[model samples]
Target: MSFMPPWFWLLLALLFFSALAGWVLQRGLKKQALSADANDVQRQANRRIQQQHLTDLDQALAEGRLSPAQHAMARDDMLRHVLSDATAAQGNGMRPQVNAASAGPVRVVWIVLCLAALSGWSYAQLGAAQTWWPLPLSQRVQITATTPEQLAEQTRAWQQATQSRPADAQAWLTLARLHAAQNQHALAEQALARVLVLAPEHDLWVERAQMKALSAGGVFAGEPWQWIQQVLTAQPLHLNALVLAGSAAWSEKRHDAARAYWQQALGLVPADSDAAQGLQQALAQATEMPKLAEAQASQVVPVLTPTPSGGDTRPLIQGEVRVTPEVQSQIGAGASLFVYAVAEEGSRRPVAIWRSTPTAWPVRFGLSDSMGMGAPPVLSSLAQVRLVARISKTGSAQKQPDDWQVELEGVKTGVQGVVLNITGR
Candidate 1:
C-alpha cells in the first residue's frame, strides 16, 4: 500500500482524539442525569414511609389502645426512624458529585486541547501551504523578472516535462524549436532526434534538413543534404525538399543540376507562387553566367524573360522597406532582409522577390515576372497580392521569434512606391 504523508497521519490522529473526547463528554452527561433521577426517587420514597409510621403511632396514643409508657417507647422508636430517614434522604437527595479526575476542569482541559489540536491539524492538512501562498513584495518582483536565469529555468522545466513524457511528439518538436531560437543547434538536434523517433513525417524531415543547413551557414552538404534526399526519395515532388535540393546544387556551382531540379519543382509549384518566384530568380542568375561556347551550343538554357523590348514593358512592383527606430536597434548587423509579393489567396507562393542586407534603412526594392520561382503566378498575372518585407536574424525565410516584418494586403499588380515596414515580431 502507498504510504500517506506525515500531515495526513497527523490529521487522522487529531480526528480520532477529537471523536474520543466527544464520546466521553456525551457519556458523562448521560450518566450524571441518570444518577440524579435515581437519587430523587429514593428520597421521595423514604419521606412517604416515615410519614406513614408517624401517623400510626399518633392514632394508637389518641384511642387509648396502649399505656402512656408504651406510646412513649413507640414514639421514641419512631423518632429514631425519622432521624435515620432524614440522614439517609440527605445523603441520597444531594446531587451526584462530579469526579474531579473524570469530569471537572482537568477533563475539560483535555477536551479543549484535543479540539484545538484537531483544528490546527486540519488547517495544516488542507490549507494552501504548498502553492500560491502570499509572497513578499520583493520575492514577487524577483519571480516576475524576465532575466536570462528565468529563461534558463523555464527551459529546464520544459526539459523535465519532455523527459517525463517521452512519447509526446509535439512537445519534443516545440523544445527543438525553442533550442533553435536560442541558437543551441546541438540541443535542438537532440530534441529533433527524439521527434524523429516519435513522429517520422516528411515535413519534420524537411524541417530538420533546414535546421542543419542553417547550422552550416547555408551549406546544404553532409547530413542536411542526406535528409533532403531522403525526403525526396519518399516524395519526389515534395515542394520544400525540391527547393532545398535546387538551392544546394546552386551553392555547389552545379548550375545544370540546379536548373534541372528547379525546373521539376517549378512544374509542381503553383504557377503564380512565391516559390516559383525564387526558382525563377535562381534560374535567371544561373543563365547569366558565362558558358563555354561549345557547351552553350550543345545546351540551350531556358530563359524566363524575353529580351527587353523598346522600353521594357514588363510589369514591376516597387516598394520601400522601412524599419522603426525601436526595431532597427534590435536588428543585428549582417542580418538578411527579404521582400516579396505573394498571392492574396490560394497558394501563398511569391510572385516576385528581392533579398538584401539591413545596411540601408528604407531600402527601395522592385520585382517583376523575371524573378518568379516557376512561372504560373507571375507578378503581371496576379490582379492583387500581398507585399511583404521581413528582417530575418537567422537568415531563414521561416519566421522566428524576434524576426520583424510588415505587409500590405490587396496591392494591385504593377503598383509603385508602396511602403512596407519592419515592425516588431
Candidate 2:
C-alpha cells in the first residue's frame, strides 16, 4: 500500500461516487418504469371493457330493442366514455416520464465512463505506474558478506563479473579495490587501468597512479609520474595529486621541486587541518636535510673524496647475507638477491632497497640514504626499521612462494656488521 501511487486514493473516491450515482439513478428509473408499466396495464384493461360494451350495444340495436335515435345516442355516449378514460390515463403518466426513464441508463453509463477516464488520466499525469510493476528477480535479492570466507567469495564473484562484463566500469573498479585490499597491487593496477579507460575520473586517476607506484615497489616514476602530471594539468588544486607529485619529485632527489609542490597544496588547505600539518612536516624535513649534511661536513676535518676501493666510505646500514645449506642448494646460478628496509610500523613499502646477483653466500652489501626508493622518509630519518633479505629465483621484487627470506626487526640506522640469513621460506 505504501508503494501505491499518489493518485490512487482519488481514483478510489471517483469509483465510489460513480457507482453510487449509477446505482441511485438506476434504482429510481426502475421504480418509475414499474409504475408506468402498471398504469399502462390498467389502461389496457379498461379499453377492453369499453370495447366489449360497444359490441353489446350494437347487438341490442340490431335486435330492435330501441329506436334508431336512441341506439345512436347510446353508441355516442359509450365512445365518449372510452375517450375520457384514455385522457385520464395519459394525465396519470407524466408527459416526459418515458423520455426521463429511457435517458437514465445513458446518464449513468456516461457518468461512470467519464470518471473512469479521469482516473486513468490522473494516474498517467501524477502517478508512477512503474512502481506497481514487479521488479526483476535479479534486483529483488541482495547478498552481503559478513566473514572472511564470504569476502573472498565475493571477491571471486566480482572478478568473474569483470571478466564477463569487460565494458562495465563499476565492476572493474570494485575488482581493483578488492585486489588492493588483499595487497595484490599488480592486479589492482591492471583493473584500475581498465577503469581509467572507461571512465577517466580525476580521483580514480590519482588512485590508479598510487596503485601503479605501489606495484613498482613504491617508485613513482615513468607511467605513475605521467598519470600524476595528467591529473595536475587538468586539476592543479587536486590535493591527492599534488601530494603524489611532490612524492615523485622527492624520490627523484628534486627537493626544491617537492617543496614547491607541497607548498602550493598547503596554501589551498586549512592551516589547522591534517593535510596542512603533513605538508608542513614534509617541508621541514626537506629544509633540514641539506643543513644537517653541511653541519656534518663542517665537523669532519680532511674528509677524503675517494676511498681505496672507490666506494662510499660511510653507509647507513652495511649487511652480510647468508643462506642455509638447504636453501643454498636450491639457489640457481642466475638467482638474484634483494635487500630492503621498511619502517618498524605503518606502511610496509620499503624506504630503501638494494639488488645484486652475487656468486657466493656471505656477500657484503650496504644500504644508504642515497638508496631510498622515495624521499622525506629516508633511512636516516627513521628511528627503527625492519630489514629483509631475499634470494629471488626470477629476479623480481615481488616475493615468490618458494623464495628464501629473513627479516630483522628493531634495527637502527647507521648500524654496521648486520647479518641477514635466508633460512626462511
TM-score of each: 0.39, 0.52
TM-score of 1: 0.39
Q: Which stretches of candidate 1 lie over 4 Å from their true place?
A: 1-164, 170-193, 199-204, 210-223, 230-255, 262-315, 324-336, 346-353, 358-360, 368-383, 392-403, 422-425
lDDT, candidate 1, 111-151, per-residue tens: 86869676886676776633424432212211221344755
Q: Residue 415: error of model 1 in Å?
A: 2.3
Q: Give the Cα lDDT of each candidate.
A: 0.67, 0.74
The candidate that wins on TM-score is: 2
Give the lowest summed-lDDT range of ten residues in model 1: 136-145
| lDDT of model number 2 | 0.74
Give the per-residue lDDT of model 2 (tens digit) for 1-425.
26565457657887898898789879988888878777767767887888888788888888998778988998899888887877776776633356767788898899789878887887678767445564422133233543448757878999899889999887888777766654467787898889878877777887788788877766787889998999999888988788878878876768788888888988988999866776787788667646655555544322111101113343378768888888888889988887888776554557677777778777777776546644345676678798988888987666677778888999988787788977869
RMSD, every candidate, angstroms:
17.9, 13.7
Q: After superposition, how far is residue 389 of candidate 1 from its true place, in Å?
A: 2.3
